[model samples]
Target: MTTTILAIFALVYLGMILGGLPFLQLDRTGVALLGAIALISLDAVSLQDAVAAVHLPTVILLFSFMVVSAQMRLGGFYSWATRGMANLPVSPPWLLGLLILMSGALSAVFSNDIVCLAVAPILAEACIRRQLNPVPFLLGLACAANIGSAATLIGNPQNILIGQTLQLSFAGYLQQAMLPVLLGLAACWAIICWQSRGNWQSSAPLPATPQLRSSDEQALDRWQSLKGLAVAAALLGLFLFSPLPHEQLALTGAGLLLMSRKLHSARMLGLVDWEVLVLFAGLFVVNHALQGTGLPATAVAWLAAQGVQLSEPWTLFGATFVLSNIISNVPAVMLLLPVASHELAGSMLALVSTMAGNLLIVGSIANILVVDAAARHGIQIDWRRHARVGIPVTLATLLICAAIFALRL
Candidate 1:
């Protein structure tokens, strides 16, 4: 049973690295689900044990926030914000700064992926109208979204997992992460600015009138938007001051949002990404079964005996970077979570693992989504252009974060 579980574990994580077995026609989520089924069929883990391994709080918290972001998206808040930002007549440098700040701020509150999705189309259109280069702004949206999501526990799936697994304080994690996030956003802007200094002036003429769509031009529900904003603000305040569990507070807020008459309960529920929740639950069980086989701890001990330690922050940071780039961030976090401690090591691991996604277009799902959206609109963001900003920005921000961790922790 032990050997079988270990074999399943190795194959599952290998699937994670390769994104699936070669020519297997499966994704990370499919691989995780299969691994869990294998463990159950082999009796390596009972059904009850699999249920116990899945973390409900993390899953619920993630689901609740997705609802919140969906409400904002439906309300046209993102479009409103991006349109306002692009309408400004500032120079290219200031416009880049605006894009960075806006992307980071919105992503800190909402899912970075959604933020990019909502804003990218309008940003592309705005650039075309202004005759400005859309490539820099598009890359800014992706990098800023990735960097900004690091600011809070609720910002991304991996952060939520890290927070719940380690029982990290919401406010405390924010305090520890805000500096790096802010610095990282600035660094992103600096790199893009330097790269596009000569190309600042667009040769294309601004359109006679901005060609916004009817759907895009529809006014946001001021009341619904205000109410959702209020609920989100209250949740953040509770995170800072109240002793209530964050998951409970967030769930309550989601419940309140569902009770609204203007938006159907089913509609809001439909917006939840059920597949992602399933993926988390399935991976949790699979990883738990593998941990039960004693291989992970034994490996850690063996490495320690050789004067290497995975528990060290820097070591974990490096491991996480490589794992994240290979398997994607969420699965990488799942694999690393058992060995993580909530101190500087875990915090650094979470931040570095996420920031590493900015290194390549495929390094993060958000980047891929943005690229797909751009291509659909006849805007191609090739690898060379993306790397011009992604590589330097990722390296600079990761270094800044590493430095901050060394000095502060």
Candidate 2:
């Protein structure tokens, strides 16, 4: 049983690293789900144990926020915000600053992937209309969204997992993460502006209007947008001051939005990333099965004997940075959560894992969404273009976060 579970774990993570198994037609989520099924079929984990392995609170919180993001999207809030930012009567550099600020702030509260997905094409159009380079702005959007999602527990899926699993206070985590997130956003803007020097103007001719799906070009719905904003704002207040479980509060907010007369629940729920939730459930069961083998504890003991501790913040930081790049942030967090022990481990994992996503285009879903959206509009941003901004922004943000964490020592 132990050997079987170990093999499944290894293969699933390999799929994660390679984006899929060869000739398998399976992505990371599919691989993980299959692994869990294999374990259950083998009786390595019973159905009840498999169900118990999943952290329902984390899953619920993630689902609830996805619903909230869907509401905002349906209401045209994201596109509206992007248009509002693009239409600002500011210089190119100033506009870049505003873009970073807006993306970061919005991502800190909502789903960064959804935020980027909704904004990317509209932003491409805006840049083309303004005769400015869209690459840097698109890069900024990805980087800022990645950084900003580290600000709060519910900002991203991984953060939600870490916060709930570690029992970290929502307000407490925010206090620790806010400074570094702010610094990182500023760094993103600076690196983008500096690298894009004297090249803000668009050199290539653009179409009179961007080619977009009708849904992508949503007009602002004032009342619906206001309603979503109100729910989001109220949730933030509750998260800060109330003792209510975040999952429940967010679900309440989602339910309230679903009860709206115009927008249907199916529309909002359809936008939820069910695959991501399945990925989490699958990993939870697989990891729990591995724990039954007692290998993780033994490995920790072996590492400690060799003076290679993983529970320490610095070690965890390095591991998170490497693993996050290798297998993506959410899976990396799940793999490392077992070894995390420091009081600040959750914060370290959440921030480092997220900020590391900017290192490469495949490092985060947000980056992928932006790149795909750009491709749809004939705005190509291959890995090389992304790295030009991503590499520097990642380095600066990680360094700033490390420095701040050091001060806490």
Which candidate leads the pack in TM-score? 2
**Whole-model alpha-carbon lDDT for candidate 2:** 0.91
Query: How well is each residue in 1-409 modelled by candidate 1, as lDDT tens digits?
Result: 8889888888888887777788788887788888999899888999999999999999989998988887787777888888889999898889999999999988888878878877887887887777787778889999999999999988888998998889888888888999999999999999999998888654444334345565344367878788778888988899889998889999999998888878898777876778788889888998899788788899899999998788877788888998888888998888788778637866786699779999999888789877876775566788888888899999999999989988976
The deviation in Å at residue 396 for candidate 2 is 0.7
TM per candidate = 0.94, 0.98
Number of colliding residue pairs in model 1: 0
Query: All models: lDDT?
Result: 0.84, 0.91
Give the C-alpha miss distance for residue 36 in model 2, angstroms: 0.9
Report the lDDT tens digits of candidate 2 across residue range 202-253. Answer: 7776556666787786778999989888999999999999998988998899
| Over 4 Å off, model 2 | none
Whole-model lDDT, model 1: 0.84
Task: Report how far off residue 69 is in candidate 1 (Å).
Answer: 0.5
lDDT of 1 at 324: 88
